[model samples]
Target: MRADARENYEHLLAAAHEAIAEHGAEASLRDIARRAGVGLGTLYRHFPTREALLEVLLRTRLDQLTQNAGELETGSPPGAALVSWFLQAVAFVRTYNGVVALMAAAIEDPESALHASCETVRSAGTRLLVRAQAEGTARADIDGTDLFALIGALGWVGDQPTFSPRAGRLADLVLGAILTPGEG
Candidate 1:
């Protein structure tokens, strides 16, 4: 791509990121293009669909969470590491309005653009869960996919417009159930 075209692409991505952060995954593409001083066609040329744009916007965060899982594996006790990573996953899934729902769908739909990102997140959580289980810190019956589902559920709770303060308590409750006695 030419330097100017590359610059336009970067600008559109930046604007889309900010718009999505503020308005959520359903934020208007046209608004994003306007914010970036680009035409809607430019945004579409760079990101053919809403899911494609969302994938790019959220890819860095998904990678960060994956990297954090690796760090937590060795940096903390197994139980503590798993708990920390679970909290981060909760945050990641709740990054935007309806994101938890989007992730839930993505996990089930192989054709979804966000499916790979969801898989990466689940793999990271799975590693933490397996380590914790091996160390007798987490419940043996629960697997990574289950944990991912729970994280999405927690994120859904957090995303409620009514703003329930019970979100934290709910997280604690789920964590308590997942962890073995006297762990987490």
Candidate 2:
């Protein structure tokens, strides 16, 4: 991508995250474009559909989270890494809100960008979860499937207009409890 195009793409990601965090599922693409300092045409050029844009924006956060595995491998304790990843997941759930419903449907149906992103999560997230479990920190019984289910279930909590402020603390409490004591 050209410099300007790259900037636009980054802006779109930032705008989408902010808008979704503040406005939930009701966030508008037009407003996202305006916040990005880009025209709707440019957002269209980068992401042709609102769904596509939301998918990318959500995946962008997930991708960052996926990278945490690498960073965690550097020296972070297994428990800390697991907690960090879960915290990031909660923030991601907050930003995307109810968007995972679309992703869940897409990944189950057939070939789609959603499936591609799911594969990404499976590969990296599995590794991270395994690492935590190896240390007996994460619950041995809960696998990637369970984690995904939990994240999806919790996304709705973050989507609620009244639930926003309490989400971070609630996520911490919920995820901490899910982890096997030390894992949290």
Candidate 3:
């Protein structure tokens, strides 16, 4: 991609994240284009549909969180790393209200792009879980995928602004539940 095109795409992703975070998924693409200081045609050239744009926006954010697991593997204790990453997942769900609905909708097709995204989260969480177990700080009965599925279910709790106050506490609650007997 040309420099200007790359800049436009990044701007669009930022605008999309901001708009969706503030206005939910119902925010208009035209408005997002305006906020990004780009033309509608440019936005559409990068993303053919609203859902496709949102998928890219969210995938980008989730990918960052998943990648962070690798960075957190050092300095932070294994248990702390797992709990922190899990909490970040909660924030992602809360920051995008209908994200759970989107995720659920994609599960019907196992080979879909969303399925791969879900697996990325699961794999990242698995790294933490494996480390925690190795350190005797996480339960051996559960793996990363199970923890991720649980987080996906928890996304419903993040579906509205009214529930935002409980977000961190709820994250801690679930993380507590998943930890080894003596860990939390």
TM-score for each of the candidates? 0.93, 0.77, 0.82
- Candidate 2 at 109: error in angstroms? 4.2
The segments of candidate 3 whose C-alpha lies over 4 angstroms from its true place after superposition are 107-111
Q: Write the per-residue lDDT of candidate 2 for residues 1-184, one digit (tens) a residue.
A: 8998898899988998889877765588899999999899998999888768766766766687778767885668877876777666656765656676766676576556667776676566667778888988887888877777676666767777687677777787778766786555
In candidate 2 the C-alpha lDDT for residue 22 amounts to: 76
Runs of candidate 2 with Cα error greater than 4 angstroms are 1-14, 34-42
| Candidate with more favorable, higher lDDT: 1 or 3 | 1
Worst 10 residues of 2 by lDDT: 88-97
**True-vs-predicted CA distance for residue 107, candidate 2, Å:** 3.5
All candidates in order of lDDT, best leading? 1, 3, 2
The predictions' CA RMSDs to the true structure, in order, are 1.5, 3.0, 2.5
Question: Looking at model 1, which ten-residue stretch has the lowest summed lDDT?
Answer: 158-167
Name the runs in model 1 displaced over 4 angstroms: none
Candidate 1 TM-score to native: 0.93
